[model samples]
Target: MRLLQVVLAAVFIIFQVLPAATRAFNFERPCYLRGGICLKQGTPDCEPFRGPCRAFTVCCKVKGLWGRAAAEKP
Candidate 1:
């Protein structure tokens, strides 16, 4: 009765408010390095190998810094 009503109200409010409050985030992964240089983008040389990963993922190599690809698009 009253409990059911409250639960329904809560669920309704969550459904209405949750999407507006949520935000998109980028995921980061570890990049592999070779001979003082980080591998180029789209290189399948990630150590502890993660295979056939998501399309948004890339091997980031900047100068001598190496890191996993970050979310570039939603």
Candidate 2:
């Protein structure tokens, strides 16, 4: 039990110590968007953007419609 507790603590500390920017996923930011399409201070096209959504968006979209990451050829 102590060994399991230690392992869990280590994992938690490692995740907590990661940089904030690395931990967050912003869809509007180009770096996060990568080669994907994003609104450039304007509305994006109604057609779904063909690339990775932000990490948070990924979770939400994944729960519903088929997301780009799932559709991409592996």
Candidate 3:
């Protein structure tokens, strides 16, 4: 129907007009400012950061030096 077409067009326009969420380097929030890395949930031995981060990602503590040197057992 013509009404359905109009509704669909409006919905498409609204989505296109909005800013898309992406993996861009985020420096404005407290997470990036405090050196938080948004790694996927449950990365082995990574400490969880209690700050806002990207969707489906957990802000993790920086595993510098010794932490990175350790090899994963697979």
Candidate 4:
């Protein structure tokens, strides 16, 4: 019974930690662009449309540069 409890505890911890580990990273704020220029208060292009505009590129979190998409809203 004690071993089972320990296993359950480990599983629970893993479940909690896994999500944090897999969390997405945001690279840039959602913005709109036109004619190859970024617009303020605009939307970005991506799979799920969160706002109006579209994303410029696949915004990914870079090491020295910016980060990737943080998370996608359902």
Q: Candidate 2: list runs displaced more than 4 Å.
A: 20-74
TM-score of every model versus the real structure: 0.32, 0.27, 0.34, 0.34
CA RMSD of each candidate after superposition: 10.0, 12.2, 7.9, 11.2
Please, what are the lDDT tens digits per residue for candidate 1 over residues 1-74?
99999999999999998776553222233445332222234445432223333444444433335644332211
Q: Candidate 4: worst 10 consecutive residues by lDDT?
A: 33-42
lDDT (tens digit, per residue) of candidate 4 on 1-74: 99999999999999988877655432233433221222222234323323233443322222233422332221
Give a tens-digit lDDT track for model 2, residues 1-74. Answer: 99999999999988887766454544333333334333222222323433454432321112235433322211
Model 3 clashing residue pairs (backbone): none
Please give the clash total of every predicted structure, in order. 0, 0, 0, 17
Let me know the TM-score candidate 1 reaches against the reference structure: 0.32
Q: Of the candidates numbered 1 and 2, which has the greater TM-score value?
A: 1
Error of 3 at 15 (Å): 4.3
Clashes of 1: 0
List, residue by residue over 1-74, the lDDT tens digit for candidate 3.
99999999999987776545332333333443255455545667654434446575555444577655222111
lDDT value for candidate 3? 0.51
Q: Which candidate is the best by lDDT?
A: 3
Shift of residue 39 alpha carbon in model 4, Å: 22
Stronger candidate by lDDT (1 vs 2): 1
